[model samples]
Target: MMAVALVLSAVPLGAETLILGTTQVPRHFNGAIQSGIATMMPTAQIFASPLRYEDDWTPRPYLAQSWEVAEDQLSVTLHLTPDATFHDGMPITSADVAFSIRTIRDNHPFASMLAPVTSVSTPDPLTAIIHLAHPHPALLLAMSPALMPILPEHIYGGPDLADNPANLKPVGSGPFRFVEYRQGDHYRLERNPDFFLPDAPRLDGLIVKIFSDPMTMLLSLESGEIDMILLVSGVHDIQRLQAIPGMQVSDAGHEAIGPLNWIAFNMGKPPFDDVRVRQAIGFGIDKRYILDQMMAGLARDALGPIAPGSPFADAGIEPYTYDPVRAADLLDAAGYPVGADGLRFTARMDFIPGVPEQGRNVAEYMKSQLAPLGIALELRSAPDFPTWAQRIATHDFDITQDNVFNWGDPVIGVHRTYLSSNIREGVIWSNTQRYSDAEVDDLLARAATEPDPEERAALYARFQHIVVEEAPILFINELPLYTAARAEVTGLPQSIWGAISPYLTLDREP
Candidate 1:
């Protein structure tokens, strides 16, 4: 009953086709933007080597044959494999490596990931030496996704590629080539015959199908129209997918699932501008109620910015508990008084419904908590994504439901959010609360420059402590990252780091 499309009539075997389903095409393909595409096209090798492996959340080599660090741990040198080549049969050189890092810094798209690099140089044709402004122990982990996904220097000259023809149709060194892209619908990729890996990328082609709604995507999976779904909608979505017959489910709980959901405050605004108010709000909401009523008790309450599974996560810091009396007292001390109508001064919280049910469910739970403290809680809902983005950028409301995309590294996700420079242009810039603390910024800066793992962890712990006490945000549930595929697919390894390789050894049942 399976529909197999044969692309090569000359090949002895039937062509393998895979239909991959997702809620949306990636927001950005730049590795710095996110890792969705890299997971799908693993055949593309990087110069620095993968910092985290598919099996473990630890670092591993991909393109770098071997690497050595100075005794002072200030400089790191990477030697490229002689046989490693791009999809176009171009031997990747040290020049290409230097260009890749330089491009990331010059271009704004990769600013999030590449801003930490102090300098990159090539001492030899096949060797790359990178120097950081200071010792960065986590530099290896930070480079894993962005710096490792090396781009050909010749493709886009050291400038913005927004208007470049390559942006629409990119040519990667990955095992797959971009065949066709139907905007807002689906994109097709064909295997690269010139791929470097041997006996890799078993599928002849891959089709990434985007659905407007989860129900339609689920129906496609039930009807065998698609082989798998990438992102999970919610806890119930996982339950529903598992119920489907003849399907395999892979769920790597906390680390892969990403950070717990939380509420972001517009710290630039009044009331929340006060640390006490922020702390009161953090203590006011009963996380247990939301867990039971909204998330179906699937998530654990996050104690701090770093989730529990992270290596840098600090467990000694006590988590804030719900106390209505304390919340009301804090509100009173902050100069907000309850009127005759019993409604204390409160601002409207803006939330966008990703799926119709999720918005209404979470908003109502938040409303219940505020009502008890004599706060006039109002909900402003946006039905779609564009509208939501606009509202958050303009700081149109008091608070919003948001989640940080943590790719196993704590610094990449948390540090930027707490930085002040990122709060410009109305967009949250990851700093949803627009929080600006000199001490917190100092800790983050020191952590980035400190190459010692112990020192970095200590600095980060101090930063987390400040945020926890200030409570600019309320920590929420860490959603599960899951993969549901057809039973025939094999050799696809399970990973907690969230860096999956679809091109690795997966094959269909004969």
Candidate 2:
């Protein structure tokens, strides 16, 4: 295997370093356990997947040189690039690929993402064949960098995988190598000279600094202490940040299907179990007002769980309009008549962390709107993400507000939010709503294995129709994703997967 040599300018006294800021610090570097963008941003640099998504959202080769699907649509064969090597200078082979697939299938939180995959076999050092229980049309798309990162078998193949100490210092065959991680401070990575890609990563090193607040992080950008913010900044701060000289704000570098923030009811609990009560709550809150006031009119009102832009979205279904009078009638019909206390019932809403201010504002707005209908809505906020995740997963909350990303495709994105099999206890963000329907399950299953793209889309459309009619979760609006950076920074590629790739592609000139 040929190795690429580090090409540093001899005239430069030191290597060029790029520093970025983020509000959330990664709990660990392992992608199989964590799904947050905070974890993906840093881990993207340290690990390489067999396949990657292009700017246009098409699957392309990375570690794997090429792939072919069988005519029966039940298996796929992958050919590895001969030049790929791990950070430790070991050749990356088909065995490592097989190990990573089995590990992710057995241990990953969203293992259902690979539910169709049955087994992996390697006939030689450069080839990997994957067998599937059924035809999965979206298998290639599901193998994007974030979902299927290739791990060094020597380090992660032992027992107690999650508890392994090497998780904090991951070793992979990506363009960059992990250096050190200072908790709550920053994480660092250096360029990999042995990377298969020839002279590709342009930057010498990368540093991601952690900030607790958005304002301080924006200030760091202005003072040149940081080059960019990995995650999108709030819309309220975008204008102010743009007004600063030499700064640019863009909403372009995000995944194709953005996240949808909505109100979810625990169907396993009371009051919410009634369809009329769920519909009453949906009509009580004004989605238009929330989109205008809370979201700064930067988002479009969601018609359903799927984004309107996606082919699978059911455009014929209309969204529930703001109607308190109708909401009150529905509540009364559901047998919760307004009592002498001027209230039908009381409930609390737990706010997820990512958008605290917007969440609280929307909660207060809903409280005021629901008051006229004789429904008391209380607002509750968790101290951190873990607390909030635990509450929602275990069905501990009455009603809650959270966001779900469709991750480019509904098969890989919105399926977990509604699939009954995904309702695992204590598992964060997997069908926490506890919704189950025989018809809906049938449609989802058919869509997963349908080889024809048009037929698959039709099946998803039917699924959306049922979900919207059932009203298990109230669809609010599509959240806009963005990334802010200084003008001097160049060569940053636009991404539909939430993070820029080819870490070496970025450069900041003083």
Candidate 3:
């Protein structure tokens, strides 16, 4: 606890208020029912999980003072900190821990992350024992705030937890307390007086301003109307903002482990069903050009679903280099020759919005590049994120541009993209491509429970090889996540996951 107190000392008391900007408004405050960085970023500050991950991706205790795993790996027991209390003044107890674990296991979009846990039992107010059906190597990592936000049992333990009114006005046991939320405007939070950590949350309050237009958000940051911009601006804007005198821009150390953008083909649809067609499209697109011209060299060419920096990434795999001639050959050999109209097939390419014009630029580039191979790609744009996600969930497009934010572990992040069981209707952002392989599924399943680190890494390496060969999605590039703030802001956390939780330690200089 002395180390924790030392970290809190970085933010002095005089640093009173902080204002941040975002393009996406939170749809709900409940972490269990919602799935997106927009919602998670805000809710993370309001709730306290038993465990969290450090920048190195190792588990660290938060609400739970300490924990132990049985030698058989069948159960884990957590000891809670006696002094911790929720924002509502209720003492945090083992009942809240057990309730949150069970609720999230049933409702979260990545519920598969907790598939190993069979039940939770509370022997006392400060003790919770979790029973597992099998060994799960990454269980602690999965308990990070992003995956398992511990909710108050009294507030969210009802039968209709998802529809609870507390979702709009949340109360939790974190360093911040909810103050107010004005839809499409801003959400405000103040420091939690009863927060267990001493001299924490140096800022008196936090304000997250919502702006639909990214340019407006940038302007706000530049004008000092907003002190920071969290996750909205693009790389191009970030580069420009860095030149300003009082602004500070950095990737926050997430470039090595961020989301990789790709073109996901609907395997349930025709043309995409053919492995040759998928391979042809992969070879046709010039990812290097996209990285240079469209991305401003802020991204790296990705050959597989897992980024190169991850432990599970396959070093032997190579990206499908840009070869239009080979692309044409594959299309012609597949019996789709150049017709009198000089077109092999016509298909629509759907683009997800909120990418700050990069999505449209990439779509246009793909259209021009694919034309030489006798492919006609009609561009379509979804009005908003929800509509765009629905199109992906329903398999309503031929090809779509999408990305997955890897949750530090492949089991929680990469598995959903290719797992056969994840191809359910209305489940947005999973394996909507519907590409399934028995061997790959088995590897993913085994990797989840493999206790040995080397053994788990080997399993995922094989899984990566299989997915790359199948070409379910056209692996593109890993984009760097940038955060720009005033020079006065300091000690902000930086990582692929828990991007916003650093706000707890952030302090502003007057």
The candidate scoring highest on lDDT is 3
Instruction: Encode model 3's per-residue lDDT on 65-109: one tens digit a residue.
Output: 899989998999999999799898889999999998988888887
Which candidate do you rate higher for TM-score, 1 or 3?
3
Model 3: colliding residue pairs? none
Clashing pairs in 1: 51-59, 135-450, 135-451, 136-451, 137-451, 257-481, 260-477, 260-478
Task: Order the candidates by lDDT, highest first.
Answer: 3, 2, 1
As a TM-score, model 2 comes out at 0.91
Worst 10 residues of 2 by lDDT: 1-10
Candidate 1, 132-247: lDDT as tens digits: 66565655665453335666667745446545555556556665666666677766777767655577667777776777778888777777777777656477877787887788
Query: TM-score for each prediction?
Result: 0.88, 0.91, 0.92
Candidates 1 and 2, the one with greater lDDT:
2
List candidate 1 segments past 4 Å from native.
Answer: 1-14, 26-52, 108-112, 145-147, 158-160, 253-257, 355-359, 497-502
lDDT of each: 0.65, 0.79, 0.80
For candidate 3, give the lDDT of residue 506: 80
